[model samples]
Target chain A: MGDALLEVKDLVVEFKTRRGALRAVDGVSFALKPGEVLGLVGESGAGKSLTGAAVIGLLEPPGHIAAGSVTLGGERIDTLPREAMRKVRGKRIGMVFQDPLTSLNPLYTVGEQLTETIRTHLPVNQAEARQRAIDLLNDVGIPAASRRLDSYPHEFSGGMRQRVVIALALAAEPEVVIADEPTTALDVSVQAQIISVLKNLCTEKGTAVILVTHDMGVIAETADRVAVMYAGRIVEIGPVRDVIKQPVHPYTMGLMGSIPDPQGGAERLVQIPGAMPRLNAIPVGCAFNPRCQMAIDRCRVERPTMRRIGATDVACHVAGPAETTP
Target chain B: MLAFLIRRVFQAVIVMLTVAFISFSLFRFVGDPISTMVGQDATIADRQAMARELGLDQPFIVQFWRFIAKAVQGEFGISYRVGRPVMDLIQERLPATLELAFCAAIFALVFGIFFGVYTALRRDSWLTKVVMTVSLIGVSLPTFLIGIGLIYLFSVELKWLPSFGRGETVKIGGWTTGFLTESGLKSLILPTITLGLFQMTLIMRLVRSEMLEVLRTDYIKFARARGLSDRAVHFGHALKNTLIPVITIMGIKLGALVAFAIITETVFQWPGVGFLFISSVQSVDVPMMASYLLLVALFFVIVNLTVDLAYFAVDPRLRISAVATRG
Candidate 1:
């Protein structure tokens, strides 16, 4: 409790579309400790990406943080001016994008991109930066790192390019890294390899990471804790294993049910009715009420905030709170 | 890479040969240079003697063969109006046109890119809108009209410059006195502005569109996210990507510039090759006219070559493999 590396307090993000100002990230709160991997899981349009973007002060215009504060290392970051925020980015918090193919500038060599970022945020001469770049490429498990530095982005394969992107993000050795769908763009086989590489590197450096993805397998494998988001709000937050084993929120339960069970007894996977609502069509009170199997009048009329249960915070009126057993 | 260069050179050679044939056929097909030369006072015997003296008395086939032979040997015969070799006249006037084109291109390129990028960055500003509207006018107005208008304002009304000619000059040591002289330079201002204005607008539009598109690419987002200043992200990362289109447009515009300068030269009455070309056309000077077309074609080929070489130089993607280029 005393040493929170990154803390996001009720972050609200909205977009000024033609229809109206739609809330993308609505009062989302979470904390990340040093060296901790917090997995942000949600269905499509859950605003998982938007929350991550807001924490880094990069919410796309006309999407902006309406009310919230993102604090890293006890300093408020979200309120900083653009230039100050920019410096805070590479120097304090780094980011990885979903698509790697377009991430690296095609004109520059892999080494040049790494070295430029390193030189910008760190006090290093060209030779030292080049050496660091090679070391980073090597650290990312690239073979013949020194030779590969001269190759352009096009010369690298998709998986390898993602690896280079990771290297570039970690160039400054920032306190935290927000990797948004880092593995979604890679092969399933390569996904495990990249995940392992990311985990090992972050763990070794003691750098906190907010791993944003829809893959439960990724959360299960890598995350110490997980936050489940639905309709731009967190529905559940707890230790990964506790929430996965003793699921609290109905939305979280439905999400887990949708994942196929390894034990073959249940022939068909459970399916939640209807789809996640669009920004305009999201129902009042509980955003998931229309699709929930156990929706009540109470669920349809009043929004629920996080209530402490057994080793978890579950947002639901029906479930109430977990009682301690004798 | 060698193969590409060889292929390009071969294509250029074929184009030159084609232009030569087209220019040669213009004299035979048009069939009135001798009539224009003799005028209403000259008799038939005088015309015949003149034809014999000029070797036009030979059979059409013989004359064609001789013309081709002489053209291949870098001769374009003599201009009746100038009473000198067409090649010599072209050589004398070509430098003036080239200097004008080069100066105009430099002005357009520098300012065009500056304004284009400036406006693109602040797209919603009223200044940007005004610049874009004025640039559209630059694109739509005829060069001769612009030339005359500039002359009207700068030369006639203001009495700031000479209205016609390249002005006088004397050779002094290594430097030329007239070309570099104050009055000569003052005479240059209107024509250069007229020649460059349209190109400036064209380049501005191209740079704006390209920069806008490039600014949206993922790499630029990544660059900004990585703590790059706006200047570095805009000019360094995004602008570099815009180069491919800018260079391509510049090459095409340069080729057009050589051809389009004729109207500007006529309006200014400047003693450049374009002005000479117009007078040659009116006087029915076939050799002079033929050489003028050939000269422009040559410049086009040269500009295209420069563009190709520039691509190889500036963009590593177009350069031979990194391994080959490393040396």
Candidate 2:
């Protein structure tokens, strides 16, 4: 953790809704080490994507970082000026999105997009940037990289376009990539290929990755460590294998149970009994107390912060280590 | 592209024919052309002689047939009021109309797109609010009123520019144009602003809205994330996407400019086809009116076709699928 390539500490992202200030990401904290892959697992509205957006300084307005810090290579970045943050973006961090089509501008040739990005962050002229773009296309597994350079994003197939997006993200050779649901919009058959492409490239380049997704299978395959977020906070964090085999938080347990195992046969997949609380309607104490099956009277009035429980960190009165203060 | 062009050209022919017939028939409702042909003191014999000369003595159907024949032969009949061929009159004034339209287009497109991007980028600013309000007024106010207001401000009160005419021209090669001459260029400013104000508002709002939409697209975010400067993101990425539709709209708007120029020319008394058109309308010069309508309609068709073709160059999806899909 001391040498984390990217560090997110107590990050809180808020949205100014018509009703009032709505806290979407409340005191979430995690760090990604050099060359490490951290999978952020959560249900919809879990603030996982918002965390990624905040780190990249694209927390769409009306939404903003209300508090906390994002440090890249030990330099605090969450509060950097717009101009400064823009420099940090492609030069230090790359971002891949949920949809491939949305991630690549349709009007530009893929080569133009890639070269512009390269020339922006790197000290490369046009010819050299183009060469790097071609190299990146080849690295991301696009066939005939040189020929693919002139293609508009739409000219490529869905999987191929996703590869192009990945190429664009990697154009500047940043230290970390925040891939928010990169595989979610791709077909299942192509998802594996994209995931492998992402994994191999990150591995080869020694780049850290923050992969935000709800797909447990993707986490199981690509993540070195996993963080489970629920209602705007990380409910648990540990090695992916440990979290999958023996989840410490009750919400994490429910999520793990919902991932159907083929060997489990014809049994109905287990689903958590209630929905995640709406922001305005979140409980006074523990946000999850209403939905937690093991919630106690104490749990209804007292929120549980992340606490060490065996090998994992868990935020639950019943499951986490004894409350040190109260 | 070949197929698309062929289909569009074929469709254009149908539209021109329909417009030609409608223009020819609409003249009947205005009553008579003779009142415009002769002086008040002229005799019945002089009027009859004029009618015979124009083939007005023939049956309505036969007169229409002769008109059609002359039109097919590319011989627009002599204007009853001016005693000159309608085509000749149009050709003489064509350059002035083209100049007015070209200047207006440049003014509208350049300013509209610039302000649109600026307002979109500064969405929450009070300046943007003021701009939007002014644009609304711009769109609502009639062109003649804008022309009058501009004339009063620049020509009457300020005495900064000429009020009623296109300025001096120097011979450029074999032809002459007011565009290059200093005073002539000054004369264009008021009229261009008046003629282009509505289109400016229209294109400005379109560019702003389109930029706003394109700015929110995932690719724009991706572009910004790539660390491109704010300028690069807006102009390089977002503006290009915004333009595809804007260009299409501009084509239709170019036609509007020509039609709207009629009112603008009348108010400014600028010597353009629109001025000729108004005089022809007043005199009920059927030959001139018919040719003008046809010419305007033809201009719209050709400009729109060019715009449609331009989409292929800007957007590969259209270019590729143009061939993939059947005509």
Candidate 3:
């Protein structure tokens, strides 16, 4: 926490629509420490994935970072030139896409893809790069890694292909990896396996991970800290245990309630009333005010900034004062 | 790989046989070859003797079988117009057509791919707009009209090149090639453009669209995410995927160029097989017509086989699946 490896301050992501510019990620901010796993949890369209993409400078055209800075190791990376940013991509920050099937080029062998990536970032010859690729596949727990190197993406099953993707992301041994819904497209049984492989590999390499997902259960199992986002903003962020046990923001409370309690028999899951507002139609103040169960008059009129409350930082006027938490 | 080739060859044989059958039928129904061969002075008895000698009096199936047998041996009897062996006539004309089609193909593929890739990568540039407009014009204009336009521009107005003919050709063995001499290459410019314009535009549009589609795929995005250089991403990955479908189209288009170079050849008087076929049609030369039909079918089959092999080379998925199915 003292020396954050990756720091994102006041990040703003906006898309230029025909009507006007719509803010998709509105002034979201977070910091990641080395060897730490930070989970970004939100429903679809909440800007969680956009936040991750912005950090690595991979936001698609027509969408861009409007204002704010992404700093890595005391240098502002968000403003670097295209070529320099590209070098920093797999060299400093790796990324894993959602679908394993589409992430790999079907024309090339996995070995060719992996070795090419390795050579792109590292000052290594072909032989060295291939050796490193083999080691990487082995680290990701693929069986017969050497034999499987020449196999194409279609040769592997969904789960195995994801493992290959993880290997590819970690090929350069970057300081940070942005895994956006890495396991979302996998089977339930295989999802845990991928997560465990990801967790173990990142932990072993001492690399920080920004895990963006909608599954709170995954966050509970993997993340040391968690940020709960809603309507393109972080409503609450703190250690996983503290936020899950004692959620200060009403949105976080509703999110926690929705997860069925396996131990508590015959209890219905909680459903939050109303959907998240579209980017253009977000409420005037505290974007979540329309669906908030504990919204006060101030919550609707004056947008609440994140205030330190105990160990957690929450953005809600109705939440108790900072000094009230033990 | 061997199995695939064997299957393709077998299919090619069936296609050739079918094409041969149709041409054989055309020989029987179309005007009398004896009437065209003997001129207006022959008596009824003489015409009957000639028909019998030519095996035209035999049953249709027996005549067809004889045609097939002679065709298999690269013999197509005698041409009514040329009064020489049909095979020898085609042999003399085939080289000119092959050279023309070859040059046109090179022109079309090189410029088509270049323009396609350029426009796709620079979709919003003014140059791209101009290129797209030019391609539209190329696609819509008819071949003969294009040939005449080029002839008007380069020959009529500029007086820079010859309007027709293959120019100075060098004889190498039995093959007469126009590529060796300066005027020959110069003379090829107008007809090549006329013949290749439609194909080039078709290829350009296809490559541009496929390139755009491939650029949007997740693999391309992933390639960029890996910090690959723009060259490696665009050419090495995206372009390879773009070329898969382009290869098949190129094969078909190439076959069409050779088979349907009639208008271009006629306009230029290039002495190619296409020009020969047109004259043979006018003279009702059945043997020449049948031989040309078989040759075009053979060209198509060979091109398709090459396209399939190229698919194996570029795409690992296809290659692996082919092996899997064989196993």
Q: Which numbered prediction scores highest in lDDT against the true structure?
A: 3
* Ten residues in sequence with the least summed lDDT for candidate 1 chain B: B169-178
Error of 3 at B172 (Å): 0.7
Q: Supply DockQ values for each candidate.
A: 0.71, 0.80, 0.82
For the candidates in turn, chain A alone yields TM-scores of 0.96, 0.97, 0.97
Candidate 3 residue B321 C-alpha distance from true site, Å: 2.5
Q: Of the candidates shown, which would achieve the greatest DockQ relative to the real structure?
A: 3
Model 1, TM vs. native: 0.94
Interface RMSD of each: 1.0, 0.9, 0.7
Candidate numbers, best DockQ first, in rank order: 3, 2, 1
Give the poorly placed runs of model 2, Cα more than 4 Å off.
A320-326, B39-48, B170-176, B325-327
Winner on TM-score (1 vs 3): 3
- Candidate 1 local lDDT, A189-299, one digit each (tens): 899988988999999999899999999999999999999999999999999998787787888888888898788576888788889998888888998899887779998
By TM-score, the best candidate is 3
* Candidate 1 lDDT score at position B209: 93
In terms of lDDT, the poorest run of 10 residues in model 2 chain A is A317-326
Report the lDDT tens digits of candidate 1 across residue range B1-327.
666778889999889878877786776666567788888999999999998988887886676667667877899889977789988888777777877888789889998999989888999999999999999999999888888888888788999888887786655553333467777787778888899999999899999999999988888888877877788788878888998879988998978887888988888887788999888887778778877888888889989989998887778776746446555
CAPRI band for model 2: medium
lDDT, ranked from best to worst: 3, 2, 1
lDDT of each: 0.86, 0.88, 0.92
